[model samples]
Target: MKRKHTYKLILFSAFLAVVGCGNQEKKEVAQAPPPSIPIIQLTTKTVTGFKEYPTNIEGVINSDVRAKTAGYIQKVLVDEGQKVKKGQVLFKLETQALSEDAGAAKARVNVAQVEVDKLVPLVEKNIISSVQLETAKANLAQAKANYSSIAANIGYATIRSQVDGHVGRINFREGALISPNDATPLTTVSDIKQVYAFFSLNETEYLDFLEHAEGKSLEEKLSNYAEVNLILANGSLYSEKGQIQTSSGQINQNTGTVSFRAVFDNPNQLLTNGNSGKIQIPTVYENHIVIPQEATFEQQGNIMVFKLQEGNKITTAMIEVKAAIDHLYVVESGLQKGDKIVMSGVGKLRNDMAITPQEVPFEKAVKPIAKLFRN
Candidate 1:
């Protein structure tokens, strides 16, 4: 009887132990993590305003250096990729024919002067007829005119650079015959000390920027801003600032963009013609709301950002974006002062979800990464 009672007690105790183990397992499973969503606190602060426009790097002055007179090139004084100054002689032409023609013209001028002197004395003394004296005077004038023309032609035989610039691509060699209207350019000269940025903006962009632009001349509704910047091909920002100069009056019917130009002081001569890059411009003028790019989400052709409300619960809101002002999106509508905004972990977020919200510092929220992507 004692042995049977001990067996029954052991069985009862074993059943209680199993029930306790099952209860402990159930408690652990219930305590696992809920869907944690990243929450950002929104604050009303002054946002920086900006708008970027597509631009290209261009030469301040581009010229095709050509010869003025026809001749065989006697000597090429400069080579390709050489720097030249204004009025620098680039090449010498075979001037034997030109020089001889000039000498003959001078001799004719001397003979005409002698005839004029003899005729003047005869006319004064009434020894010669008036008609004969007039004829001699006319011949003297014609000879002088011919002499000047030939002298000018001789001067044009030497090729000189018209601008201060870097020379490019020599097309002719020594002893090569060149003409005034040859299809091949002998060389090219480009002044890159200050580069011109050629670009265009539509009428809508013009209207948005017109108010912020002040104290500058406006042509055809486009105005020059006091400052500009250049982005290089290797994704570098030019240190110098440029100013807008002018714009063409008519819009290009095919592209629907008006032509404009800006001049940037390129002291290092780093920018060259045909270089492609971007231009950032300040377009809107106002104290507006801005949110971090991470906080914003795109859904169904509309941009939505989550705002934290009472009890740390998130609520969905739609915002009207004016432009991406720097690293932040400048908000036009649908947000107010003192609204709590979520900054990071936006990809794992949804509407009406509860979160353990914490306020991050403003600098940490607005600070942008150095990586640049074309807008």
Candidate 2:
């Protein structure tokens, strides 16, 4: 009986030992190692930042065609976008009525001359007073002046191009009445050999731009300004780059913006009076620190990144971004060269969390991921 009782106690001890070992194994499996996170050290790079502003292109000379005298349009001599020369007749007004009036005026002048001649002969023969001859001469002068005025009106009926360029949209067709007082123009003519790009910036941006430009005077600053690029509405870049020329020099009180002008050569007449595009101005930063935009996350409206610290820990850092270049950001403040930051998994990180840092080359970390998927 004593031996059987000892055997039962040994069996119970064995069962307990097996259960404790299983529990220890399970606990060890649940305690996983800290996750490895990719990290990169910040480094300076020469990057170009682009700022685009919507602009409308205009020919260097845009002239509105209007009738100087009221008349019905008898002809439209040119089509839209047609090239024309100065003094080319664009429209010929119906001058039948003016012609009739001019003929009547000429007949009156002839009749008045006959009367003046009759009075002069009668005065010479002492058959009429000198005052009567003078009156007849005055009447003859009035009729001649009237005839000359009517002839001038006949010439004014022909509408001609005042400039050398391409014709724009014709506002009126044949038989449409055009007047000098009309609000709408007959058509527009544009000299498109070179184009002007008009763009605007807010007061704040204008001030910031002037502050960065290196020159003592506005003219010198404009001359020193970097060349700009034009992006067409169809998303194609223009062949020729443009230069910043003039500025309005005053803020528009109603819009709170300042206007700027840029000039571009349009050799092919590709640009017109009202072509729209975007002006892309590049801001170059030489040897400035840059980091991957993906490595950053917004917290409480501030841009932040997970900084790698001692003991392989990460803490949230606030960084001031000056501009974006491709998929990277140009750092202005709050970060410097030689600072280690988590390259990825920033979304899943918490403040002061321990991590396994997998250091990567700065160039590899900031490689534009967007370009990788391009066809």
For 1-375, candidate 2 gives per-residue lDDT tens digits of 999999999999999999999999999977877799999998899988888999999999989998877889898899999999999999988889889999999999999999988888789999989999899899999999999987887888888999999999999999998788999999999999999999998999899889989898989889998999999999999999999999998999999999999999999998998899999998889999999988999989999999988888899999999888888988989898999999888899899998888899998887767555633
Compared with the true structure, model 1 gives a TM-score of: 0.77
lDDT of 1 by residue, 63-173 (tens): 887888888999899987688999999888898988888888889889988988888888889998888878888888888898887777678777889999988778899
Q: With candidate 2 superimposed using the best TM-score fit, by how many Å does residue 152's alpha carbon deviate from the native?
A: 1.8
Question: Model 1: how large is the Cα RMSD against the reference?
Answer: 4.9
TM-score of each: 0.77, 0.88
RMSD of each: 4.9, 2.9
Model 1 spans > 4 angstroms off: 1-36, 47-51, 54-64, 106-128, 183-191, 215-226, 273-276, 283-287, 325-327, 346-349, 370-375
Question: Which residue pairs of candidate 2 clash?
Answer: none
lDDT of 1 at 88: 95
